[model samples]
Structure formats: structure tokens, C-alpha cells
Target: MCRLFALTSKDPVSPMEAIKALDVMKEGHDGSGVGLLLRDLGGPFEEMKDAPILSGIFSEEGIRKLDLFMMDQGFMTKYKMSIKVPKQTLEGTPKRGLYLLRAYEYPDSWNVDTLDEKELATRLMMTRLKIREMGEEKKDMIVFSFWPDTIMLKELGDPMQIARHLGLDRKDLKARTIMAQGRQNTNYAINLYACHPFFIKGYSTMTNGENTAFIPIRDFLSSRDFPGYMGYQSDSEVFAHILHYTMSGLDLGLDAYKHVITPLQDRDIENHPDATFLKHLKKSCRQLIIDGPNCVIGTLPDNTLFMAQDRKKLRPGVVGGRPGMFAFSSEVCGLDAVIPDRDKSKDIQPMHLDTAIVGPDRQEVKICRQTEPLTLPL
Candidate 1:
């Protein structure tokens, strides 16, 4: 997360002053924005456009750094000057655009510094109130913002599952926001639909709030205290369903979110069965064994390559999970490799093999190979 900032006071400060205060503290934040929500003292609420920070730093003595990133990191830039630039020319023609239209038009532009007393009194106040109302209603407002990473988006999937587990459809769940770390080397920050109004990382004032009900996959599937997942190989949706069931069955808080890592461990199922919502995740393991032996593999619809395949040998094996991990393979070799139990019933036999690791999202990697009906260690 780049930074976090928030304020609640009877009398508001100038946007310029607010920007200067936050800039001084911003660690390495490349960009910043502000969300203005105004409540008319028990009357209708509204919000204004998110303001951006200019390409300068502020300190006790004034702007400490200048053009560090060399980008117009401020709310009003060459294009957004109308909102933050202030109006010297006035009258019927008006020196600037209407506050509401202007705020929404340049939703991405935010610079707290350029705003003056006149702008704040006439424009900023009313603008903030409208923006706040929208934020409260939709709950998807990007108050102050920054980009996100893949992990954060995947993490969101967990909360959606949790909502479904509790019988809440995608539409029924309350509003929430998530943070995504950028992929390339850029200042990272969380994106949110905020209501409570808090600071980003530390200094950036944000409109988006932490509203998601889901937990990270690692945390969600960490234990066997809940019913785990089971599904056809190569089907992420099915895996999600089983996970939802496990969390719901165990009564692990209806609104709670859970997460599971890729490539589940055998011990996750062999042990800790009593600790999870779904104790008998392996009951469906036989399907992998029954379908395995030899097969050809292909990519998913998106064809983005999300996993690495490891096929040591074509072996007759069983497949299960750490409760939340699902098998994904052309035949079932991948499943056998992960969960090999050759005791109770082993009707299927392996002859050749092909392996590929896929998902978490959209990617795949192939590794190793095999030949002949092989026996695997349980």
C-alpha cells in the first residue's frame, strides 16, 4: 500500500496545506489522491472528485522535494487545472467549470495544494458531499487510489466464495474495496471503495475503505478444521464451490473470507482432518486415480499459462487435498502425483504421462514426463 490519510474536523483546512502535510510524510509514494465526502449536518451527503498531488514534496519549510518523479502527481495538472487551479477570471461566464461536473469529469485528477479559500467554500465543500453520498451508496468508490497486483485480485475471489457460502449472491454482499500491488516496479497502493475515510499506507487521503469480507487464501485454507475442496481437474470454479461449502459447513463466520495456496500438500489432508470444516476431502480423491494413466494436456480458455507441471512417472495413484487444493490435469496424472494412496482400491493404471502446473489465476508451466504403469509411494 502506498500511503493512507484521513481527517474529520469542524473546520476544514486548505487543500494545499493538506497536500503539503501529506507529501512531507509520504515515504516513496509516487502519486497521491484525495476523496472529499461532505455531509450537510444531518442533511443529504455528497462527494467531490479525488484530488491528486502535484510533483513536489512538502515539509515544515514548504515543498521539500520538487519534480522527483517528474510527473504531474497533483490533482490539477495541465488538463485538470480547472478544478484545482483556482479561478482568477469570474462572473456570468464564470472563471471555472461547475463543481459537480468538473469533479466527476476529472475523477482521476487530485491535487490538494492548488485549492484556495474560494474554491473550498464554493466548490470543494458541495463537491465533497455529493462524492461521499455516491461512495456510501455504491461502496465501490476509489477514494484516493493506486494500482494493485495479481495477488490482491485473486484474494478477492475468496471473499466472493465466502459470500456465496453464506448464501449471499454477488449482488447481495455489502460493498468493499481491495488493494492490488503493481506488477512492474511502480509505487504500490491499495484501491478501495471507502466509507469510514482513512489514510492510505499513512499519508494519502483515500475515499475507498477496507470493505471486503474475504481473507487471503493462505489464511483461509491453512487448517483442516473445515471441510476442504474437491472437484474435477482443471476447474477453478468447482474448486471454489467446495471451498465455500467447507467454510459454510464448519460455521466459520458467515461473512469471513478464506484463501488457499496453489499446489496443496498431502499432509494437509493426511493430518489436521479434525481441524477443518471438511474433514473427508479425500473421499473424492479416487476420481483422479480412476481417470489417470496417460493423457494429453492443453491450456484453458484464456491461455495465459498459470502453473508448472511435474510428472516424474506415469503411476497409478490417488489424489486428495489440503482441503482446498484441487487437481488440474489432462487425465489425472497431476492428481496422482500430489495424493498417491495405493491401498484400498486401485483399478486404474498408468502407462505414459504429461504434466502441467496451472492456475491461482491464468498461467501454466510444464515439467518432467513418464512411461509405463507405475506404482507410487503412498
Candidate 2:
């Protein structure tokens, strides 16, 4: 099994805090790889929130190609943060040429002030896909995310060791929200694209268990003709895509997400006040049903953090923290390591029918249980 930890705060916090929590639950994951996604960025990035930042690894040739491509597309570099890797490679880590997080100004042809949000997202996603395709043959560049106010980093090695080597402890790399995963490498090759905390557009998610229904779900998603849903390097990547599809594509409310992925039995559905809608959703999204033991933790475009369990609730997860800060971790010890001053009594371990959500306000946790009447949050 893998381990998942996510933290959201009113103020910017170092990603190292989340990494330290993963260390506290070291036994749960093998030292195969680590993935981190930071949103609501702070420091220098705070001022450039409107700029689209591209986070990835690139070779010398890849950087040259990227520069040419961006210039052709009329995108100008606004700010760049290039990490300095030591000459001596750290043990168990791959030798990477350049680790970069560069923000860019909008292309000259596009008027950002007049463009629709969806159109803007499509343009950004298409640009990222084009760049990824350009580097696929030689493996020269590996792009994780191209979004505003977000940065993604992934590498092969121990979480702490990788963090130190990448200079993640720097004060400038802080964010108000962070999601991390310590991969176990149970199945699939140890490829960087297979890392958790996958992102597309503004949705991001990390899982702690296998996705038994990956093939069917993958085929269904790919059939939708959405370019952003093409990559299935890891089984858990579908969780993020499914979220984007449900919310953005279908225009469904957040509460409908858990119901769509894990619908209730016929008997239970009949008792629900929204049974008609639930039945229609179950029938239409039957292929999207997720099987196997898993716990999904993710953040929405609004920066709302949430954790949901599978029907069997085989995996472990807990959410706890005081006002202005909240953490969703695979184990309680992970939370203790980060927010020791939190009220332990209020810690929530969502069951099979529950989804624990902490809104963008960072005020309190709201438990949305399947048994209760579906009420969409405002």
C-alpha cells in the first residue's frame, strides 16, 4: 500500500512539513518514489498568481527546444526558478539535468482579460500536451503541470532525501496547500509519470491503494475524446480526471461525486430523497465505478481539500487540525507529527459512506455522509 498526506493552511507553509509527516509513517510505504503538489503558492509566486507556471524536468537539448517553442507561440517568460542540483548524485536518485518551475506571460494573440475561463484552460492544457509530445521520443522533458499558482515535483528516492536534494526546504518554495504521496511500487514500472498527486487543469488527487477497476475506467475516460484524459501511466491518475469530468464536464455538484463513484445499493437508493437522480447517475456512470481498496484525497479548483473512502473502507485515513489549518493523512501519527496542537478528539476518520471536506475558508471540517440528504455546499 502507498501513503497519502495533504495539508491546507490559511498561511503559506513549507512542503517539508508534509514530507516530515510522511517520514513518521515510513513503514507504510517503500522508498520507491515521492510526488508533491503545491497550490495557493506563496513567496515570489504569490505575486505572479495570474501567470501560468510550467513545472518539469528538462535536458539541455529539451530546454533549447522549449525556448524556441514558447517563442513561436508568443509566450514570454515572466519569472523562472531553476533548482541547482549537486554535482554528486544522491544515492537511489536519478541524475537529472535541470529541475525547473517557470511562469509565463500569455501569448500575444490571446487577450487574457477577454478570454473565457474554459477557453483559457484549454489553451494552457493544449500547450502542455504539445510540449510533452515533443519530448516523448528522447525523454528530454517530463512535464507535470502547467497551471497558475501551482507547482508539482516528483522523483525517485526517499521522500526526505529527495526533498533535501531538490532544495525544497527553501523559504521561497512555500505554499498554503500541499498534497504528497510516498509510493510503494507494488505494481507497474517505477516511472516518474506513474507518480501520484496527478493534475489536469485545476484538479489534483493522490491515492493510497490499488485501483482494481482501472482498465474499464481508463477505456471509458479515453473514449470521451478529451486530450487531457489520455495519460494513464498510473491507475490512480484516473481519480483526478474523473473529478474534472464530473465537475467541469458534466456540471455536477461536489456532493454528487462520491455518489457517482460509489453508489449505494438498490434498497438504499430507494430510501434516498434524491433516488431518481441517484439512479440516473449510477446507470450513466456505471463504468466509472471504482473497485478495490482505496482512499482518495484531493483538492478542487477552489482549494477545498477532501478525503473519501471506497465502499469497503479497507485503507486507513484521518483528517485533523485546528482552525486556519487542516491535514488529511493516511495515518493519525502523520497528523500528530504536523499538527500536534490540534484537538485530537475532533479528528475524523471518514467511513465508507462519508467524505470529509475542508472548505477554502479553512474554518472547519464538514462530514458529508451518503446516508444524509444530498445538500450541495454553497
Candidate 3:
């Protein structure tokens, strides 16, 4: 398993000192990086990286002779787990702040994307604009958070053919994740959360005959979901359609031509009503949980929830997905946990909220709130 550690200090410290205090030894050979905080006195944070080799400290012992660190994946992960660091080294230097940590598989694998104080502010600017767009809708809007793998399946041509290419038995594979080398490995990696607006367009266009659209909530209101034979091709589209139907109570199709598998129900039923459309939707959503689709992204007003791994249950009040405050996690559960708490805290909340409200009407909005700048730890 790979091990990672993050550190923050009250004062600025040398990159070398930070690593040593962490008790990260030279032999670990894990790639390392140092990040500096950037702000709009100018630009975004820029990343600096170095290849890992044997630590120079180890060269004197003749185990390896190199000033640079080697990015030996195995060696780095195994030993770094137990490395220790002293807290005293964090005393007064310049400005104190938070940082990131990671274990790189290769020196070349190191990647950095930083948000400057101004950049973060700018992001909030864009988010507010989005929220405004959402608010402008005459009808309630729902977005289908498409799972990337499902889109990949549609992209790879017919599902059965993809299964065959992956050497997966029709009986075992669900026509997804092209099984590589006879159902042993997975080749078609799908990053569901990474789904961009372009991908949404691709998936939306796959319907058999009806003109499907990748309508941004800004432009179109979705029609209700219908059965496959009735013309609904994908659940994501259906999800949006149903939400619009629920919010508007206007049928997009005529009764003579339409058939309802699940009848549309009223959203404001005071007492629990059986056999309503809302009830049907709830039942289906619960069933979907048991069906094993990775719940990486969730659709909610003004935000979306994305997890790196499956999340069995969701805590209420957790919301995220502003442009700058992207969710980052090794697994879905990790991100779910991180998002809610981070979003609630004083530090992240203002920025997230500020972004959502600034939509199209405003050209620029200045942020009076300031967060202590952060750096990425080695």
C-alpha cells in the first residue's frame, strides 16, 4: 500500500528539513515535491517537482550514489509508513499554513494544480454565476450525474462486442469494464467524476431516434422519463426528465401517445400516498443502491457530490462541486467525508457559497474574506 503524509508549519521551513523531520529516509526512493502558495498580489500556485533517487545522505554509505531521489514505487511505499516527524520544527518562520501530501508512483507522475488566493476568489466568482443560472429556471432542474463507465460502454460500440473484446463471458460481465485478458484485468478505465460537459453531450446524443440533448440547465428543461420502448434511452436523461416533471406538473407528451410505467405523483402530498410517482422514484433509487453503480457524483441544487469510492449512505447537509473547490479523494467514501465537513467549516463555506451566487449578472465580485494561504507539503 502507498503511504502519504501532509504537513503544515507555523513558519516557513526548507523543503529538506520538512522531509527529514518527517523521518522520511533516503532509501524510500519515493518521488517528492514542494509546493508554494500563490496569491493575487499575482497568480495561481505553481508546482515544483524532483525525481526520486537514493537520498544523498545515503550516498556516503555507498548503498547508492545520487543527489536526486529515485522513484522506486515499492521501496518508497513500504518504508514511508513508519516514518516519524518532530513537531517543534514548525515554529515561527514566515507565514503558517496547510499543505498537501502524496506518494508518487514515478518521479514523472508528479502533477500539481494549485489555486492562488485570487484564483480561488475567481472560482467563487464563476460558481455564483452558475447558481444564478440554476435559480433562473422557471422549473425545478435535475441533472443526471452520469457514471463514466456507462458512457464508456456506449462509446465502445455495442455492449456485447465490448464484452467480447475484453474476453468476458456474457454470463459474468454486465457488458461494462471491458475485461482484459479473459476477465482477469480491467482495461477501460472510467473516471466518472471527471465527466466534463463534452462527455455529457456525447452520452446525451446516444438515443435511437429522438433528438437527445446535452442541455445545460441554462437553456432547456428536460422531459419526463419513459420506458425503453416508449423512448427513454438512458437513466441520466430520465432522471432529469422526471425531476422537471415533478417540479412543473406539465406533461411533455400527449396521453394518447404516452404510457407511464411509473405514474407521476405530486410532490406535496401531505400524508404518505401509496402508488404515487414520487414513491416510485424513491423505490427505484433505493434499488439502484443495491445494484452496484459507483455513486461518485450526486445531483443537488447548486452543487454535486462526488466520491472516489462507493458511498453506502449520505449524511444530510453535505454539498460541494464549486469550480475551484473540486473534490479530491482516493475513494468515494473519503471524498464524501471530506466534502461535507470542509464545506461546513468557516474556511470553505464562504468561498463555496460565494461562487454559487455570482452567476451571469456580475462581471466581477471582490471577496472580502481571506483564507490563510496553503502549500503542498513534501
Candidate 4:
């Protein structure tokens, strides 16, 4: 199993904190790869929240093509943070040329005053796909996300070692919310794209169990005709897309997400307050239901962090911390490494019917159980 660690705090913290937490749970995961998704960013990115940031790796020729393409697309480079890769990288780390986090201004042709959020998101996703396709042949570019206040860094090797290789230990690189994974490489080959903490638009998620229902779920999502749902390099990628679809596509609430992905059985649904609605959801979303052993941890567009388990509840995960800060990990030791001062009695270990959520305010965690009333706004 891969080790999943996510933290959301009122103040920005370095990604090294999460990396160190993953190091504590190093025994659970093989040193195959590491993926980090930082959102609600800090440092220089904190001042440029409006600008969409592109995070990925690029070769020498790829950077040239990216610059020209951005120019043609009318996006101006507002700010760029390029990692200075050391001459000698840790063994097993891929030989990457350029690691970049570039924030771009709105296109010259667009009316910034009238542009809506959805339109902006669509344009950014399309541009990212175009760049991805351009580099497919030579493998010059490997773009993870193109969204505001978000930056993703991924590489192959031990999590802590890769962190140093990418200069993630620096003070300037920080975010209020971070989702990280230490991959085990049990199912898929050791490919960078197959790394965890997948992102689409503004939603991001990472999982810690084999997705037995990946193919059908992928097929259902692909049929939706969404460009951002195209990459299925890893089975866990579907978790992020499923989130985008349920909340953004269907206009559903967070509680509805657990219902759609892992709906209650008929016996349980019959006792639900919204049984009629739940029945319809189960029937309509049958293809999306996940059969697992999986534990999913994710962050919404608003920076709300959540963790949910499959029916089997085979994967281990826990959330613990005080108000203004919280950490979710696959093991208690991981949380102890980050926020040891917190009360252990309050730590949450969500079961098959629970979804532990911490809103963007960094307030207390609210556990929403499947048996409870679905009171969240729809």
C-alpha cells in the first residue's frame, strides 16, 4: 500500500513537513515514487492567487515550445519559480531538465472583467492538454496541473530524498494545504504519470488501495466527453475525476459524493431519511460505485480537505490536530510526526460509512456518517 499524508492549516507550512511525515511511514510504502499537490499556496504564489500556475517538468526544447505556445495563446508570464536541480541527483531519480511553477496572466483576447470562473478553468485545462500533447512524442513536457493557487511536483525515488532533489526544503515553497503520497509500485510500472495525488481543474486526490473498479469507472468518466478526464495512467486517477464529476458536473453536495461512489446497500438505504433520492443515486451511478479496499483523501476547490473509506475499510487512515490545523495520514505515527501536541482522543478514524471533512477555515473536523441526515446544501 502507498502512504497518504495530507495537511491543511490556517498558516502556510513547508512541504517538507508532509514529506517528513511520509518518511515516518516509510515502512509501508516501497521507495518507488513521490507525488505532492500544494494548494492555497504561500510565499510568492500567495500574492499571485488570481493567476493560473502551471506546474510540471520540461526539457530544454520543451520550455521553448511552451513559451511560444503561451505567447500564441495570449497568456503572459506573470511569475516563474524554477527549481535549480543539483548536478548530482539521488540514485534512481529521473534525469529531468527543468522543474517549473509558472503563473500566467489571462489571455490578451479575453475580457478579464467579464470572464467567469468556469470559462477560465476550461481554457486553462485545454491549454494544459495542448502542451501535454505537444510533448508526447519526445516526452519533453510532463504537466500535472494548470490552476490558480496550486502547484504539483512529482518524481521517482524515495519521498524524502526526492524532496531534497527538487529543492522542496526551501522556505519559499509552501502551501496552507498539501496532499502527498509515497508510492509502493505494486500494480503499475514505475512511471511518473502513475504517481498519486492526481489533479483536475482545482480538485485533487490520492488513494492507498488497488481500485478494483477502475476500468468501468474510467469508461463512465471518459464517456462524459471531458478533456481533463483523459489521463488514466494510474487507477487512482479516477478518484479525482469522480470528484470533479459529482460536485462540478452533477451539481451535487459533498455527502452525495460518498453516496455515488460507495452507496449504501438496499437494506441500509431503506432506513435512510433520503432513501428515495439515495435509491435513484445508486441506480444512476451504478457504474461509478467503487469496490475496494481503498482509502481516499482529497481537497476540494475551496481548500476543504476530506477522507473517505471503501465498504471493506481495509486501508488504514487517521485525522488528528487542533483547530487551525489538521493532518490526515495512513498511520498515527505519521500524524505524531507533524502535530504531536494535539489530543489523541480527538483523532478520527473514519469507517466504511464516514467521511471526515475539514473546511477551508481550518476549523474542527465534522464527521458525516452515511446514517446521518444529508443536511449539506445540494
Provide the clashing-pair count of each candidate structure: 77, 0, 20, 0
Q: Which candidate number has the best lDDT? A: 2
Error of 3 at 210 (Å): 30
Please list the residue runs of candidate 2 whose C-alpha ends up more than 4 Å from where it truly belongs after superposition: 375-378
- The lDDT for every candidate, in the order shown, is 0.23, 0.92, 0.21, 0.92
Query: What ranges in model 3 sit over 4 Å off?
Result: 1-198, 202-275, 280-290, 298-378
Query: Please, what are the lDDT tens digits per residue for candidate 1 over residues 104-152?
Result: 2223353325656334333433333333343444332212212110001
lDDT of model 4, residue 327: 95
lDDT of 4 by residue, 98-131 (tens): 9989999988688866989788789888989998
What shift in Å separates residue 305 of candidate 4 from its native position after superposition? 0.1
Candidate 4, residue 94: the lDDT equals: 72
- TM-score, every prediction: 0.20, 0.98, 0.20, 0.98
Q: Give the CA lDDT, 0 to 100, for residue 370 in model 3.
A: 11
Model 3 clashing-pair count: 20
**In candidate 2, what are the lDDT values of residues 148-170, reduced to their tens digit?**
99999999999998998888999
Q: Candidate 1 vs candidate 4: which has greater lDDT?
A: 4
Residue 366 in model 4: lDDT: 92
